[model samples]
Target: MGATKIDRARVADTALRLLNEVGLEGLTLRAIARELDVKAPALYWHFKDKQALLDEMATEMLRRMAAETAGPAPEDWRRGLADAMSALRSHLLRYRDGAKVYSGTHYTDTSYAEPMERHLRMLVDGGFTPGTAARAWFTAYSYTIGYVIEEQAMGPDPSALPSGAEAAANPPADPAPYDLGARATRLAGHPLAVAAGEELFTRHDPGFRAGLAAVVEGIAATLHPDGAKRGESGP
Candidate 1:
């Protein structure tokens, strides 16, 4: 058989698939090449290095997210902000180490510009100044990204253990589950911590929503107080 015709998209797609199988630490050019039925050097022709490939992968991930999360921007800035962020968090949680893969990587194309502009415009239309809108978006973005990083860290591999070099590169990041009884025992000295553990560790969905609501409210109260009232034109 002949070598598979490789392109940047092909490489990124393969890397993303391997990401769940091996994870970010274990994802390498050589492995991707093996999957592609090509030598590692052939991959370098498209992606100069692993980081370059990662950048492409991140871009593709964002592109997929944009495609999957299609809707009219909510007129209410708070709901709009929360909805946008919720979608982002959902997308980032799709792959193993997904948040890490997306965190620092730059988009390889202008595809991100449209979605960002649409969101910023949603805030601006809701009465925020352009600068404040950008800041508001960044605040939510930072919160969601940081939250997912910690979430992924808590249970890096939700399935099987890492094997071979994957194991060496990334020892299991799994932490002990802080159940109520365990929390009471392990954190007996700190009653508050023990009490908080249930909400903090065991209840991720509600906790995230509650925190996001706080973030939305804080932004309205602080950054653009009038924006919420103006934005309340829609659900």
Candidate 2:
């Protein structure tokens, strides 16, 4: 395609694919231009620099996330917030180093406004003051983004162990030589330590969900200081 035909969407799409192949550090405007079979300068027509391209990429990802998560507004604003966050996490995990890429860039596009308004409205309807609603949305968003970044950093799950033959051919090295069993035994009298140890070393999904639940609960508590509670909304 000609340089004039190469729009920001096309550039962002190519950049996202390159991200999965080369990761965030390796992704560059030149790399995207190469992928498009064009000179590096051609990409500059759509994006001023790598940062501009990254911002567009982040905006595109969030655009898709907003679309996928959009529907009839939920009656329970907490549920709406939770579902929106879950969708955001799912979208970020769709690409390699996605959370890092997303966290590094800002969404400057007008497309971001709709979802932002929707989320803010949900929180406001949930009894939060306008300022508190904005804070609540960002607080949850920051938590999800930070959690996913750490989860991605840890690499894939060990429980998805390699085949027996593969394991025998290339046995994984034990970075932490301390026997978890023995450590658990030593801490048997301290239930809290044992639980904390287990949570620290295991797959992060359950813990992530638990933490997300706590965050939602905290938001709910803030919205409803009295013993009375809001009615649950249907999916």
Candidate 3:
């Protein structure tokens, strides 16, 4: 039998696995090539460089997400949008430093054409104006990407807080890492937030959700003049 010609996706999958074990810093073209049992030059023939390969991997992961979540209904746009963001967050968090691969990268690539078409069509059918639809899509994209970037960089959720009594009972005399969370808790001052202090810092998804909802709602408001009047739609 002749020597096997490896698929480009096989290379990418192996690279992602290496990312989980050794992380972004240790990832390299040569390493992936080695893992795939191909020559480094062969890998370069498929992807021009490190960033190019990473961008391809990110795009591929997103394509997988779109395949799983690309369904539409005018009445269901809000949940559809939320589900898309949630899926994207989960995929990026699946590998070590996955967000690093996606941050500041292009997802508007031709390989993403199908999902792009689906997303835009859903927005249009949801009664969004052209500008409003574009803004909503971009806003959700930015918020999700940014949240994941910070999520990986910070190595934990930023929203976590301590119990109120626990916070008050053992106030640190000196500056402490937990001090920031405590201070945020005091500053937030919402009744529900105070009651859920320990649960607050668990994840960044809620903040991201709130932000996307606001953007989607704002866009919907402008697109459907009666949206603020009716309150049953989103971009």
- Best of the candidates, TM-score: 1
lDDT per residue as tens, model 1, 97-153: 999999999899999998998899999999899999999999999999999888877
TM-score of each: 0.86, 0.76, 0.69
Q: Kindly report which residue stretches of model 2 are placed more than 4 angstroms away from their true locations once superposed.
A: 1-5, 157-197, 223-235
Point out the higher-scoring one by lDDT: 1 or 2.
1
Ranking by TM-score: 1, 2, 3
lDDT for each of the candidates?
A: 0.85, 0.77, 0.70
lDDT at residue 204 of model 1 (Cα atoms): 67
**C-alpha lDDT of candidate 2 relative to the true structure:** 0.77
Residue clash pairs of candidate 2:
none
Per-residue C-alpha lDDT of model 2 across residues 210-235, encoded as one tens digit per residue:
88889988877654433124333322
Q: Higher TM-score: candidate 1 or 2?
A: 1
TM-score of 2: 0.76
